[model samples]
Target: MTFTYTVSPKDWLGIAPIVVLVVMALVLMLVDLVLPHAGERSKHTGPANFTVLPAVGLLGVLGAMAAAVTLFFVDHPTSVFNNMLGADAGTLYADLIILAAGGLGILLSPAYLKRLKLVHQGEYYALLLLSMTGMLLMAGALSFLIVFVGLEMFSLALYILCSFIDKRQTSQESGMKYFLLSSFASAFLLYGIALIYAATGHTSFVDVQKFVVAQAHGHAPILLLVGLGLLTVGFAFKVSAVPFQAWTPDVYQGAPAPVTAFMSIGTKVAALLAFMRVFGFALSSVQSSWMPVVWAIAVLTVILGNLMALGQSNVKRLLAYSSIAHGGYLLIGVVVSGAAQQNHIGASAVLFYLTCYLFMNIGAFGVVSLLERIDNTGSDLSDLRGLWYRRPLLAGLLAFFLLSLAGFPPMAGFAAKYYLFYAALVGGHPELLIIGVVASVLGIYYYLRFIATMFMEGREGSHASSTHAAFERIPATPRPTRAPTGSLTRAASSTRGATAVAEKPASTKIAASPLPATAEIEPTHELEGWSWVALGIAALGTLVTGVILPFWLPQLQQAAQSLLK
Candidate 1:
């Protein structure tokens, strides 16, 4: 009936990433109020043109990363706030990834927010920082109480972000669904934690491990198994595993594109890290008991997630299913690491895969953002038709990202999957390996469909223009569409300049105004430089990081080993 607790300086070091993030978030939130607009930036100014919120956020995340590097030298694991959280290398690494995701989310947000005419940029960035802080806490929490707190903190921020576009009923529905389902999952997780505590007389992983070791003489306790199963289901929902993944497709499709991108990569990574921590470290002794259950879940996740994804018409929903399938792939690594006791390899592969997943997911969604600009609707597959002619660079990036998701060669996703499959092989799990391979093969269809719809196929007449009541209420009638033009040589070049102008009234059509030919040529030179830069960074990261795997893998391997220790 008693919980013994200890606090130490080492515990602070374990949560160093979070502490730095909190400080940064506060600073950014405050500074955003006074920051000047982007148009106000002068090239010869005394300060850089970076907005206050993004600048502070990036620096804070970098600081968190630096602290994580420092955490590597600290040896002992310590719990603080009466065993609320534990600080160790494993958690520090997870925090590092969480921080990186936050930084990227900030970078991708502003331009999109501006395009959509969303207000309260400061509040948005502040909430993002807070969410990152919560993820850092989730990665490090040692006890169930801390875990619940961390999960709520992250979940609340995300729910609000999802519904930020208040005018869109789909966005509101997405947030409400996530809020209700997530609350239900959290309650189960908490109840499971309580049950485990009742059976073992402890909530901390260390104490639970000791208690379980003490109870080794008896048959496996039913309460303990039930509790563990409940907890696993809770995590399965968070990571979008099969059966529990019902919310994913709707939520991803309805939410804003950037938020979907953030959730796809960031939320899954943090939850998986927590999942790995509990299953690989806390419950390692119960491997024989939980292994079969998780293995079945993994198989189902792979089969169902990929197979169902093939039928989706919406791009976001398709990627949602794709993420679930990828979760199954990562679960294979988790199973290998836990069952075979090669925790380091599994952990390393998970981290590497998560990093790779982020880049490609962001690239894919960035292309979605481009298409969404034209239609302002969800990213249906038809929206991507003729994308190659409209935006060649974005189309190519989307294809590359899709190929990566399909685990094609020379891409980071391929390398990440290879490491995972290798881990499964080394761990002697042939069944999981087979499931992974088969699922990946099935995944190729949807991924290729995306590419083909965007590039290879003819420009099909998609949705007719819908009425925009806020603007002129044009009747919902189909426009006379033209055949696909292979090149943008003549008519496209003439209309290119007017297309870049945002917020023009729908009634305004590009008529051939009597202008000098030389004047018509000038606007073509004024490119949308910022969008190109964003695309370039995303594409470059995807290509550069995977190509240098040899250099990065050693460092990741070292970090992974630290968690095992």
Candidate 2:
């Protein structure tokens, strides 16, 4: 017997974003090969360096965004490729979020790579776009097979990107750790999918939902329950909830800052949306079985994430913990969405909160990226002391982002939290509201501490002394010297007015210049034009979302409705 499959033009349209990204990534690789290296040509030449790669990648991302926007407005929710994927408002929204984050990450990368002398721009942009494609695939996946493929696709790219900073041993360690742990999680997820298929004879979400509904009001099979438990564990690891969160801080601190910023927002958006789809819709009939477990995890994540962040002196590690806490907040929306009564409200809240989070989180990390040194040093709290006195604009922007993350008034974070707590109450889970409130209160202390360190604290002499002490510890290279000076040398020195000019090698000229005091260190001097553009976009996004939130609520509601359908 022979089998045949046919694809429609509309199917092509449904996947336009992925197609564009993949093609552009290939084109970029080819372009990189043809372009001359920086040493081979003059700096003024357009292709002399990798500068054009980022611009091309950014254009690709914008094209994908346009396609996603068109699909979203067309409002045609359809299952394509034999139900392997689905296109709807929720998927489109997730795609847009991922693309925006990817674009900002690309914008933030050119300066960071150049400053650190990690100039593999072609590979960097290609991997970024490819990983984004995988994220979009995961968001739209309708079957376990597609989910596994998308998960592995992005995970592999991220593992490489994590270790891209070849000079840092910590970067290599981070890649190894993520590879090992994430592979273990993927195995568990796959096994769970196998068990689910064995028990229900289905892999598609729609089929699973049907089977679950039919089994409602009866005792669920032990195999099915076990599969669900394993699936939950796998996803919990991906989201960095509590005990599974051990890898987050180390990886975030070691990886390049642009990579961290991208992963922090993009991975969460994709994984959380998948979690909602699988648990909130597919397995929602068995809510009574899983609700308590997820509830405990959510509470623990919020408390532990906030508590751990309080003692962190490294900005990257602190933000990693902050990401974990935000995951807990997102879980509240997930829990409420699973409730049969007010699912739309909870679902809409999740989408809106993610939208708000993308701006503030990226903005915060952009500042950290600027402050980082080429050798992977800096980013310590002491490095930020008296920041306002040095760079007022960056200091003020960081303050704004920190305030938003702490859920201050007139920010999108506050609006998002209000919607989430409201959904919890309406869904009859008032306890979630109480826990979220307390967690947010505890979170304020750490966020404010960072701001206070930058503005209220005075520059201490210890920092300068420590820096100078470190500088003095370096062993100076010995240079060849002439024999003891004779009367002729003395006569020549006298002829030169007793002052001899030393002729040093060209390479040492820059190093021999007077070093600034540690208290006056200005890391932002390394920032390039593209980095500032990214910062501006992130700040504008933060302000716009907060100011126009009321006008955006109804659209969020519609997106939520489409997602549930």
Candidate 3:
């Protein structure tokens, strides 16, 4: 007997998102090379003089997003290179979220880099495109080999992006730590793939699924279970869950804010989407084995991520822990999808929550980045004190994003969490719902602390501003001259005298000042046009999408139905 193999155009079309991203990445690289010193010279000057690299990179990311949306309408999932990549609506949506996050990262980078005085403008934008491309590929890959390839691509780009600030030891330390741990995790993941291939003589997810189902009662089942466990550990590290999450806070603190913002969402989406696809479609027959494991992981991750975040005075660490907590919440959707046997409603919940997560998480980080001093440090919560008094619009947006993250009612985060729990309940997982609710309650403390600080606290002492090395080091712009020591001491003494008697009463009556009237606001010399615009866009997009999710859920459900098919 003879066997025939066939491939079709749909297979080629399936890879369009990756193709779009790669092509745009090349375009950004070429632009970087071709742009004359005219743009480079402006780097030393004010924000108005900065180049259009940010805009160009964003256009590329948007183009990729558009292509991904178009791919959703193509109505077929296709596997290419002998089933190495699987492109479907799920992959398309995941790539869209990654691309959108990358675009925002590009927008935020210039201001961040400008502040740090580290200007390799071209390469920063290029690396973001490249990293986004890897994430897109990872989202679509159907075979273990392809998944590994895509994972490394994304990881490598991120390694470089993390260490982009050559001047900062913190950035270098973060890059090295991520690279070492990630390499170790990838080895386990690849070993698991090798073991699976050995048992079934196939690395494609579809083939692996068939093989597992066929040998459900045999020794192959044991081997497959071991491999799956190893795979789970690998992804756990990437998404920073529980014990595997030790690296997240350090990495977030060390890397530039924009890079951290981008990595937090983009990496999690890619990794978790693959986690769901692997277990949901491939190893689902043995769901009983992994379900309990993921269940335990979910509960622990939620509780630990939130509980640990409660004492955080460092803003980046707080967000990092929050990201881990949200990872657990997203995992609830993952588990629901895994356990559900009927419609793809559970998978839809994962998609909706991830989509909402990208916006809200990135928006909050973008606000933190905006408040950071130029050298990409200074992520302390104290920096955000009185933010409402200085920039009420930005502060209000940040508050909204935080509340959404805490899963408060009526916001998109609430809707996403509601669907996630509802999907779990529909699938008969009440324990998961209880854990989620409890975790959410634990999340309240740290989130509210920042909110309270912004509204209630006075601005930090003027002495605090001088501690920012990035700000003090900006050579072209002169710093405000300080008063002589004798005068300063007298002023301090006078203020202390005035406050001593009133301190208790003053604290109770202080209302958060509305944003200073625009005309009355002090002129901040170092504000970069592109950076501020990026922050604005991120904040605005988050609010708009979060508000419209109720309207979008129907279409999202339609997309979800396709995944179940």
- lDDT (CA) for every model shown? 0.71, 0.79, 0.74
What is the C-alpha lDDT profile of model 3 across 159-199, one tens digit per residue?
A: 98888778667889999999999999999999888877877
Greater TM-score among 1 and 2 belongs to: 2
Per-residue lDDT tens digits of candidate 2, residues 487-515?
23442333212111111111111122121
Candidate 2 — which pairs collide?
none
Cα lDDT, model 3, residue 199? 76
- Top candidate when judged by lDDT against the true structure: 2
Which pairs clash (backbone N, Cα, C closer than 3 Å) in model 1?
A: none
Across residues 178-206, which tens digit of lDDT does each residue of candidate 1 receive? 99999999988888888888788888877
TM-score of every model? 0.83, 0.88, 0.85
Clash pairs detected, candidate 3: 115-374
Model 1: ten consecutive residues of lowest lDDT:
466-475
> After aligning candidate 1 to the native by TM-score, how far in Å is the CA of 2 from where it should be?
8.7
